[model samples]
Target: MANIKLALVDDHNLFRRGIASILGQVADFELVLEASNGQEFIEKIPRKMPDVVLLDLQMPVLDGTATADYLREHYPLIKIIVLTMHDEDRMVLHLLEKGVSGYLLKDSDPDEVEKAVRKVMDEGVYLNEFVSRAMLRKMTNKTTVVKQSTLYNSKILLSEREKEVLKLICEGLSTAEISDRIFLSPRTVEGHRLRILEKTGTKNTAGMVAYAFKNDLV
Candidate 1:
């Protein structure tokens, strides 16, 4: 398999180098570019299109949120993992809704960072304990209003099988695992997953999960 091409965008030189060094040790990871801020990263995207980007939220010129928005609009296939110190639930939800593939704190274990990369590649999203807690907390908040949209009306939009598949997905079950649990072929499970994404108008599984929680679809 070709290596997973990676780009690092962070203002902190020491942090960028530290992450680059760790990712460099992985045989399947290739550090293709490094930028100190979002503007520089956006400028280099045409020349060095990375499969995944480790982006920091706080940066000069342009921020991670803006960069992520640009990527979602222009290069939807490239996965983004927010590597930052912020652990605020609201920020995590905001980024997830914008279609970021993962969120990892800077103090996370190095192995977790590597695992997050692989999981996002395979599963289309990587939700850690922190993210899960954030989702749960949001779910329990009575004041949180569910965004009403025709595309996200669960009864009107999703079939029974699709709902089942989505619930399993939110439970962190992979395609094969969901297949086994639901007594369907992996290909069939993937079909359901894709249709669910389409009906929900989500960019990836992370976005789908966020939508599910917010709209009480799962």
Candidate 2:
């Protein structure tokens, strides 16, 4: 397999170095770019576009939120993994809605950082426990605020098979795993996944999961 090019964008030099060092140990990960802030990252994108970016939410010039928005608009294919200290539910939900591929805390285990990079590359999203809990809490709170009748009327708008696939997806199953469970070929499963994404109008799994939770589809 080709090397998975990665970029790190954070204002903290020590933290950035630590993450770079951790990811450097992975055989297939190549740290191709490093930026102190979002503007620098965006300016350097043309030189060597990475397959994934480890972004920080707090910075001096152009924070992670704006950087994420720019990348989603201009380079939608490049996966973004938010690596920051902030774990607030609102921030997590905001980034997910902005189409980030993953969110991780700065204090997360090194192994998890490596895993997040790889998973996002393969599955297009990586929802760790922190992100999952945040989504659930947000969903639970929203359920109480929104009327049950309104929530029920927001139709799923998915076929039965598609709904099955989506449920498995929201459960964190991979395409291969879903294929095995549903007795469908991997290619067919991928087809179903694409259809689900189209129907949900979501850019990636993170967005899809967020949509499912917000709409009580899962």
lDDT of each: 0.91, 0.88
Off by over 4 Å in 2: 142-156
TM-score of each: 0.94, 0.93
Write one digit per residue (lDDT tens) for candidate 1, span 1-218: 99999999999999899999999999989999999999999999999999999999999999999999999999999999999999998899889989999999999999999999999999889999999999899888755645443335735568899989999999899999998998999999999988988887778889988888877787
List, residue by residue over 116-209, the lDDT tens digit for candidate 2: 9989988998988998898789777864537642654365477888889988998889999999999999999899888877877777888987
Distance from true position, residue 13, model 2, in Å?
1.0
Task: Give the range where candidate 2 is weakest over 10 consecutive residues by summed lDDT.
Answer: 144-153
Question: Residue 197 error for model 1, in Å?
Answer: 1.4
Give the residue spans of candidate 1 off by over 4 A.
145-156
- Scored by lDDT, model 2 comes in at 0.88
Model 2, TM vs. native: 0.93
